[model samples]
Target: MDVSQVLRMNGGDGDYSYSNNSLLQREVITMTKPIIEDSLTNLYCDMNFPKTLIMADLGCSSGPNTLLVASELVKSIDKIRLELGNSNEPIEIQIYLNDLPHNDFNTIFHSVPKFQKKLTKQMTSYSSSPRCYVSGVPGSFYTRLFLNRSIHFIYSSYSLMWLSKVPEMINTNKGNIYMSRTSPPSVIKAYHEQFQRDFMTFLKCRSEEMVRGGRMVLTLLGRQSDDPCSKECCYVWDLLALSLNDMVSKGLIEEEKVDSFNIPQYTPSSKEVSNEVEKEGSFMIDCLEVSQVNWDASTDHNPIFSKEDAQGYNMGKCMRAVAEPLVLSHFGESIIEGVFERYTNNIKMSMSKEKTKLINVTVSMTRNG
Candidate 1:
């Protein structure tokens, strides 16, 4: 499948929009704030208070989360400038918020006015007001999106795991939308190889576009083990697969269609990420932190809690916001409601049996000459 055409989060600011259901992704972004701050600080020092800052937020799905990143970068720069008592020269900041063409760029664009006003109010108290320009760049990150040596810093969160396309040899991965315990050995190898190629391409592209010593911070779901079928990597997709089977049983979806479909996503282990970086030979790793958040952590304000009455339906809504476009592209519109109903029930059942958390890997890197 042409994932670039089909793989998009539910768009717009409606109840099921990515903007509303992406709290989990926001938490992931929050977890990487310190690394991002450090990267910006280092860039400032290395560049000697550069007058212009060019950056991009890859896989930046719409909503407050996209604006949150812009806010953080501007704030970090302001903080650094204030601490150093830098010259009164004005700094111009340009941010390219990037996602697939199908992403809800309109929602992000519409928020730009309010975002700028909020930034203006906050900056009135500060000594300097940085000129910040935010715009959406539509394309696949797997390809070049910027000119060579243009971007000074790059940030991505909860997005790198999506492959440009499904693996070619996935025909053997029947009854599973992702790598699973029952997947054949060839199926596992196909996924691993695909991730390696896609990740290398990502590094290579960034390396070309970024100046020497530039920093890039990325956060995405990952497995703690090399096992492609590890719980941390596949459990969520396994539940979805189970839900699809239930749909098949009830005559809601065709069994052959379910078997034929596979999500073009792969959560790699930290070692796998490190190996690819080292192999690419363009960037040096600064930090590779592994963190975990509960599956239902997006249900409320708090990201942590003892299992109370699990909000399984809410959790399913969050996942649907992310996975719906892909499913709709594959299974058509007929089974959408029934599929999610079964999927939400599966989430509830699994949470009752045991609590589970998704492992996230945040890697900070600096471009090397």
Candidate 2:
């Protein structure tokens, strides 16, 4: 149940190469822009109109999304500058992009030159001098990742729900065999416990790292309801089970091994998220919203796959990428490739029939005095 181990199963490298689908890019950019603007305004207010500020993009993956986040920040800064008027004093803007130690730092760094050029082009409209610095600080978000009170604004996307490791309970022999995806009572409880522990730690660490009144915006996957045992929950453990079943039937995996495998828990409710923040007593909630991500957009456009292959492949690949580590560790690597292949084909088939989507939860908060 080690979450890091599961993450490593997907090639251990942090460079998750994603295709640049214009529609998907636009969707994420639109979702984040308002939150970024609101957080910046609150941060500016908290700073009492400071001429300079610092911001960090926590859990920033190497992709077009990074540039989108930076663009949003620059626009926010421009709005602030327009309100303040031109002055001899230059505004100091420091931006830190953070992620796991194993992430592709080279790709992220290589993109900086292009980002700077883009920033320069965008800033031409503004008359005032603004000094901006962007750098990478690699580490886990559960621990202190920055200097104390150094950040004014923080943004993280689609990354927070991943606990540092899998829940310990799931690893024990007494744990239910179906704990990974099924809504077993013991499995649900164990997941909740781990989530609370990890989330509280996140709040405590951020509280210490952020200056009083600093603002943060986070968007990640979440459940529709607060109930932990609901069948129609956010993480869709059943779908995973279905995909695993396909693998077992193909003789790529043993049925007995699949019985003991557990999918890492997700689907944290808004109430759960709020309670964690309040417990920390340092952050004031500004906004919380949940929306669906168009995960099946590609499928809707593709007509090549057979129905069965389409359904199995699209969902299977999406889930297996995250679940493969668990499968490999428990069942061995001999059958993993075929299992994944079947699952991917299934997902593709599913996608051919209808569009698929991912549920997302967004929370915006500011430090309280």
Candidate 3:
């Protein structure tokens, strides 16, 4: 499948839509706000506080998280303006929200009016003509989307793990989608090679598009261990594969179909991420750290939904919002609900054995002059 043309989160404001189910992503964004703010602060001051600050949010899927990030960035800039005694400097902000063409840009565009209104209210006191402009850029981030040396700050969260395409020669990864303990060494090699190529392409494009001293903050799902098949990274997919297998056993899905499906995602190790930055020689890593966020982090934020299976159901819905489109395209919509029901049950069962968390690698970087 052509991921650039095919991949998208479930759209609209429905219950299963990515917009509603993206609280986990929002939580992660909130968790990393301090890092992003600090990095942007340094970039702003180092650039001598450009009168017009230009920035882009790559893979900015449609959701609260999309505008939440934009608002946070605006706040960070205003703080710098205040610190530098330029409160009346009349700052102009240009923001580009980017994702694949298949993403629900309509929802984001519809939400922009409210976002701008809210942002305008916040800047009324110390700033004037500090209006913010937002536009959606449609295309693959693996390729260039902006003019050379135009963007000042870049931010992406929980997005880089998606490969441009499923790895070639991945037929060896039968019966399991994504990397698993059962996947052969060749399968892991192919996935890693694909990630490396895509990531380098990303860096090369961004390097050409960013001014000297510009900053980037990226948060991607990664593994704590060097091993590609570590439980922390692969177990989510393992349980998902198990769900598909359960369908096959019930004769709801063909075994061959289950064998043919492999998710085009790979959570890299910290070493892998750092190695690519060093190899690409475009951005200098200012901070590279790993943190674990529980699969049930959303549960704590929403108190109304306390129940025996809330966490499992919540996580299952979250994954569905992100993964349903791919699953629908591959396996048909007939088995989608059944697959996730099994997935939720499997998650609850596993959580009983031990609590699991997503190993997140958040790296702050600056363009090398």
Instruction: Indicate the residue-level lDDT of 281 in model 2.
Output: 83
Cα lDDT tens digits for candidate 1, 22-69:
878888888788999898999899988899999899999888999999
* Clash tally, candidates in order: 0, 23, 0
> After TM-score superposition, what is the CA distance of residue 139 in candidate 2 from its true location, in Å?
1.3
Off by over 4 Å in 3: 124-126, 300-306
lDDT of 2 at 109: 76
Q: Write the per-residue lDDT of candidate 3 for residues 1-369, one digit (tens) a residue.
A: 778876899899998899989877888898898899889889878988788989999999997889999998988888777887877788888999999999999999999999999887887464454668999999999999999999999999999999999998645688889888888888989999999999999999999999999999999999899998999999988998999998898999999898778888889988899999999999999999888898887553456655546787788888889989988899998898899889878987776667878899999999999
Instruction: Specify the highest-TM-score model's number.
Output: 3
Better of 2 and 3 by TM-score: 3
* Higher-TM-score candidate of 1 and 3: 3
Q: What is the lDDT of candidate 2?
A: 0.67
Output the number of the lDDT-best candidate.
3
